[model samples]
Target chain A: MRRPQFSALRERLLRAGVAPRAVRRTIAELEDHFDDVRRELEAGGLDPKDARSQAYARMGSEEAIVASTLARPELMSWARRWPAVAFALLPAPAFAASFVGSIAVIACLGHLAHSWLGVGLGRSPGLQLFSRCFALWILWALPTAAAAVCTYAAWRRRISLLWPAVGIVLVGVLGSLTNFGVQWGTATSRTAISAGIGISTGHLLPPLVRAASTVGLALLIYAGCWLASRRAEEAGSEG
Target chain B: MGDAKALLMSGVPELLILRLLAEREMYGYELARAVRAVTREAISLGEGVLYPALHSLELSGLLRARRRQVGGRTRVYYNVTAKGRRRLEYLTSHWRRIATAVEAALAGPQHA
Candidate 1:
């Protein structure tokens, strides 16, 4: 399969530290210009290959274009200039906090259900199951809430979801790894985590399997949040 | 264009761009064609100069860009802002002043 011409240009611009959103917009605009020129040339009876070459010639040397764009400091996105700091500052802390907050809420509810309600009132299997499901559902809610916040941040910056998406995945990986570290640290108890699938803490999940599952779950949450934020922003911009 | 003429044309691209965009919203390619046509082929803007100028203009809030789907192609069209129009008027007056001075100098002094 033929790779799109613009893909290589996009990669080069990105490698040169151009902002991701600017790279995308610049590539799209240039591609549109080149295609329009080629179309016009072809209509004048030039062959497709010749027309494309002429179109490129009209656009000027590739190096000059790229260099000029890079020279324009205004076009460089904040994230592009300081990627490490950008990833560290944004969405990561917020995501981690949201995840931790969700876990705390789940724990508090679980305690209330088991001690306050179940023992004091009546031991009900349905209430126990409800508590477990609620905990899992709430755990999933953490990523979604983080996604919404990231999306809003992106909109405010007049940027696309590139950083937000990266932030979500990065924080997700960090969270899962932290969980794995804790599990590894305290491997004595046979804790039964009644996630959608009940896994006994005694026979701890294989490290590989657990990591894969964690990453998978994180991805699922990221995908959901990404879609929600995109849709919401689209609706908001339209309104 | 001579070195002197080229040096003098440094800021003309932005002026011409704002002038063309003042007529109607146009994408880069269309604006480029308009520039050449309206200047009677006296001016030709390379894509490099045009795109960067457009971006900087938009950044400075002198122009607004909107992406539209036209005939299945994504085209970013630019329109001059009120500020852009005022800038264009100022540049136009400035250019006319220089032109009048240069024409008088070229025509030689006449006895008053």
Candidate 2:
């Protein structure tokens, strides 16, 4: 009977993962449509089996039906919500911390460089400019580069071990550079003042403090981003 | 005859099922045929719609299900609980109010 054909179609749709409620609703609508088509075929003197087959052909292919059902807005909306949330919250904090910390470490290094090199290079404009530029690149620019790389790696979920390792390396290198720059700048300026030459310790302190604060902030941001990335991975796995 | 019967049958089977179980219990195919006979073939419900609604109503705690062997086929019977009766009363009263308002509105405009 056509009943078995209808039942088998419904079971196939269900096994393909159509929601039960939607399956039932679609089947009912299809049955109603089939009934009208079947009656017309009967009036034309076609056998019941031929009428059923003709009706099935008119309704279109199984792939088309399944695709149309999945394309429904409500089903798509339900499927996309979790993945979108996981992506947004995952990498934000670590990126912030690394960026802030890199800036702070750079400032601290500038301060130390000014203190240490201020005297030896003061008489030579060419030497002083080169030393200042070199200090800034080593202390500030390098850490910024490292922090950026770490953040990108974490976000992409590639090489899980590399992200934390690179982050640790950046903090250590930048932190030392900052300390060295501050102490150097301070010692150089003190030597200049003691030699009866004018020098600015006031300027150096602010940059040093800023550098230290940046390091702290970057660490906070990095830890936060790392935690968030871990949580997103866990959520993705569970879902 | 067909149009009148169709209008009456559209939602009446659901209401009747609720009303019938307002007293006692019944199984799947039995309920289908009983509903058909009660409406004198005005409404013919398939097993498709009936079973799903029964399951949903059971899930919502308005009804409970039990299985029994009948005519060599396993049949699931449903009985209305206290919650079911309460929901039925709420639905019936609200429906009556809506129906009365609609009827009055349609009749008044036509008569005028």
- Maximum-TM-score candidate: 1
Tens digit of per-residue lDDT, candidate 1, span A5-108: 55545556666776667776777778778888999999999999999888988887767577667767888767656644564367667766665665566556
Model 1 CA lDDT for position A156: 34
> What i-RMS does every model get?
1.5, 9.8
Clashing pairs in 1: A190-A202, A191-A201
The lowest-lDDT stretch of 10 consecutive residues in candidate 2 chain A is A190-199
lDDT of 2: 0.53
The true-versus-predicted C-alpha distance at residue B10 of model 1, in Å, is 3.1
Candidate 2 has a DockQ of 0.02
Error of 2 at B66 (Å): 0.5
Give the per-residue lDDT digits (tens) of candidate 2, residues A27-75.
6545654665566678899999899777666555655555445544332
What TM-scores do the predictions have?
0.61, 0.35
Whole-model lDDT, candidate 1?
A: 0.66
Q: Sort candidate 2 into its docking category.
A: incorrect
